[model samples]
Target: MANLLVTGAAGFIGTNFVRYWLEHYPEDRLVGLDALTYAGCRRNMDALRHYQQFQFIHGDIGHYENICQILREQQIDTLVHFAAESHVDRSIHGPDTFIQTNILGTHSLLKAAKTVWLDEQPGLIHRFHHVSTDEVYGSLGPEDPPFSETTPYAPNSPYSASKAASDHLVRAYHHTYGLSTTVSNCSNNYGPYQFPEKLIPLMLVNILNNKPLPVYGDGLNVRDWLYVEDHVRGIEKILSAGIVGEVYNIGGNNEWKNIDIVHLLCQEMDRAFAERSELAARYPLAPPANGQPSTSLITYVRDRLGHDRRYAINANKMAYWLNFNPDIAFASGLRKTIAWYLDNESWWRELLARAAP
Candidate 1:
């Protein structure tokens, strides 16, 4: 059984990964560490408390000594590094935090892993998997081929730039210091437990509250959307069989324009309300309850600064080598995400209240 340390365990994708790990690897000892930032909700891990083999630590990944201590104490042989400042808009407004957390924080973790797993206990079986985004590949044109593992780095925003630096650091560590590391650059991820700041969740919440659905630019920006669960599975495949020094691209192969996604979501919302009478009472402010289409709330807004026009990931490497592929269809995944938010109203409501100024 692999003793594992998962950073950002309280955040969206991290939370799902933690749950998946615990459920599938019951015999493995797992420890989750999180700084509990605005996006890293402590409540997200409340359900995992019942597991005897899991432990949660409230801490930041920026602290080097603390990470060293955790690595040594937990005897952690597998470290899945997921902690980072990931919001593009927030990073654009305030880049200092992104630089600190994404670049410096990742450096600190690498240092700790090297000190504990390499210098102190050489030949100790281990793997350090770093999670990253495809934004580092910059924008793609309508006719451009999707980004592959070999795609050159051309980051646009502060968030993507910071992540690109960290990705380089991980690669450097593997090549220079012989650290057992692998990197996966994934496309957009959407699923349950995702913070409302993201596109899908933001649109869903606004549709429920009868607020305007803000679409950036012409809402024509295209992205490959991978469900969080499929992304997690891709990571597991990398850990199980991927080469230590190689990079993998994980994608859903489902590219949807921004406005088209919003429109589809609106249609799904309308269907939900029409099929279930209880939804109308639960979200009375929603346009669906008042016999109006959720599309009525669509309101175009200025596009984000340094916004990349499109991002598509070519996961041929992951499929050909690791035998991995995303199983969830876009419609099925979207429906599940919407149902999750509606059933767990208290969760998102509390997060919204906390985020309110």
Candidate 2:
């Protein structure tokens, strides 16, 4: 059984990955390291308490000594690093945290891993899987092709810049120090347990509360959407059988404009209210045929600073080498995500409260 350390295991993708790992690798022992920052929540892992093979460590990855201790104590032969300051808007407002966490935190983990795996056990097999985003490739024009592994780094926001730096660090460590590492740059992810600050969840919450749904600019900015579960599976593949020092791109190939996503969510919510009695009472609204459609709640806001025009990914490498396939279509994933938020309002309420200044 592999001893796996999953950093940032309480955040959005991290939480999903932990659950996915438990399901897929029952024999493997796992340790979760999280800082419980504004984005990280213990509630996400509350359900995993009964698992015999899982342990949780509430701490910051930016602390080098702590990371070394965790690596040594856990006997972590395999690590999947997901901890990062990921929100573009938040990174823009306060870039210091992004630099501290995404860049410094990643460096700490890498240094600790290098010391443990290289210095302590030279012959032992180990892997450090770094999860990243597609925003590092910058924007794509209307006619531009999807980004591939060969795409040059051109990060547009502080969040992506920090991640890009961390990615470079991972590559440098692999090339210079020979640390076994692989990176996967993924597209936008949407699913259950995701913070409402994100697109789909935020829209769902706003629509449920009958509040104005904020849309950035014309909402025409495009992003390829990957279901969180599918993205987790892709990460597992990278850990299981990916080539060393290589980069893999993971995406849904389901590109949609921001406005289109909002429109789709409105339609789905409308259909839900019509089908479910409780939801109807909570948000009694007519169908899209009515002039007072739920889409009326859409409120255009100023565009985000350094917002990318489009982001698409070419994940053929994962498909060809790892046989990775993202199965969730946009509509189906949106429906399931909406259902989850509607069913679990208390979880998001607590997170929103923590985020409120």
Candidate 3:
């Protein structure tokens, strides 16, 4: 059993991973480190507090001394990097944090890994697994094939650019310095504990509250969606069996247009609300789409600057190399996601309150 340092363990995907890892590998010890940034919520990881094998560190990955000390003390044999400034819109307004965290912070962690794991124990097996995004491949035309492991980097936005740079750094460390590493660039993920600012949770919350559902541009942009739990499974697969010094692209093979997803979500919200509302007395029979249904909440807005048109991942390599398969269908995943947000009103409410102006 490995002692793992999981950076950004308080964030959406990281929290899911921590719980998943602990549940599956009860013997392994996990050290979760997060700075609790705006996007990193401590409550996301509250359950892990009771797990004796899991410990949460209130720390930053960017700080070299802090990371080196942790690596040395915890005897971290593996590092799973999940920290970053991930929002594209936020990156457009502010790129500094992305550079500082995704790029520089990655460097610091790599340096610490090299020092504690490599320098001290020269012959020990170590892994630095970087969780990245498919956005680094940039946009694809309607007819373009999905992005493959060997696809050329064509990052479009500040967020993707930062991730691309970080990917390069990981590759460089593997080749030039021989630090064993694996990078998996995954498609968009959705499920429990996602910050409401994201499309799925945001639309769900808005629909329940009867607020306007903002759709960017014509909402025709397409994305490959992976359920969050399925993604955590993929990460575990990579860490256990992925070849060192190789990059893997994890895709759900589930693609949908933004508008289509919103429409479906609207309909699902109507169904969910119908079951919960005693005052409205309109639960089972969904309201007409033309009436004041959730779909009616859709309001078209300006498209994001430098928004990519489409993102589809070619996971054939992951399939062949690791037998990785995404089991959750989009319809089932969407329904489950909506149910989660509906049941966890206090969770989203408190997070939104903390983010309020």
Candidate 4:
């Protein structure tokens, strides 16, 4: 009956993690804290409203007093910190929020945890898990091996830099204060309930609307894609069995260039629409253009600032040590994700409408 406090539980990955734990560990108490920012939506966790073991707290990790109070009130024995301003594009447009949320917020959480956990009994079975991104390693050459836990920190964008700073603070806490902590740096994640601003969901939505699908920098940037469920499983494994003060890298081993992913998604979407059209005459609204289908929606856009050329992860450590292996392949995962978006149009449409200025 361990009490787990998960921050950023309304965001894509965090929400998935909360749902996963609730379903898998029915006896354990789970507390979710989120500020309900633009990216974090309560709708993501709507399905869990009936779960008795789950609780939700509206707060920001950047506020030290608030966090300390939550920790104490919730009797949190395990902390999974996922709160951060994660979008690279948003970070580029405004870095102050990224620094404030990713660095200062992490600092505040760590301080509160130290004050609460360190002062308690010495052998308490408490763990602090930090979720991070491989972007902290910067871009890798085409031929370079994937990023491992041992990879040096070389963050490029403001988002990655802030994540790097947070990672450092977590490590410093472990080394300096003997706080039991583990960190997992994961590659790009894509799946259901993801905000539309991200690459996959954004493109999916645009393609559905017959709008131009923006591809950055000729769409050559490569990233290892991990399904959100696989990522959640890896995090759970690390939280349950990982050694304290260790770092693990989670990846799908399914590396694809940006252009390739878009093409694949377009193909899946076309097939899906074709199937839907067969069921209803007015489905898709617009027929495939000529013989080209929705792939024609791809439109090259300006590259992002300091865009990393490529990012891959060497997940051998998680595989051999933690027995973690992603079950979903890229193609199958993309199909499922696309189907989910198609099925849950109302969910994303509401988000899109709210995002519209």
> By lDDT, who's the top model here?
1
In order, the Cα lDDT scores of the candidates are: 0.95, 0.90, 0.90, 0.90
What RMSD, rounded to one decimal, does every model reach? Answer: 0.6, 1.9, 2.5, 1.6
Best-to-worst TM-score order: 1, 2, 4, 3
lDDT tens per residue, model 1, 97-151: 9999999999999999999999999999899999999999999999999999888
The lDDT of model 2 is 0.90
- As for TM-score, the candidate ahead, 1 or 3, is 1
Off by over 4 Å in 1: none
Highest TM-score model number: 1
Find the 10 residues in a row with the least total lDDT in model 3.
Answer: 282-291
Worst 10 residues of 2 by lDDT: 282-291
lDDT per residue as tens, model 2, 1-357: 999999999999999999989888899999998999888989877789888999999998878888888888888899999999888999999999999999999999999888889988897799999999999999999999999999999998999999999999999999999999999999999998888888988888877666788999989999999999999999888888899999999999999999999998988887877677676554543333233568989999999988899999999999999999998888898899988887887898899899899
Check candidate 2 and list the clashing pairs. Answer: none
lDDT (10s digit) by residue, model 4, range 1-357: 899999999999999899989999999999999988888888876678899988898899989988888888888889999999999999999999999999999999999999888875456778999999999999899999989999999999999999999999999999999999999999999998899999999988887677898999888889999999999999999988999999999999988999999999888877876667542232354335234577778889898889999999999999999999999988899999998988888888888887777
The TM-score of candidate 3 is: 0.96
Candidate 3 at 20: error in angstroms? Answer: 0.3
For model 1, give the 10-residue run with minimal summed lDDT. Answer: 38-47
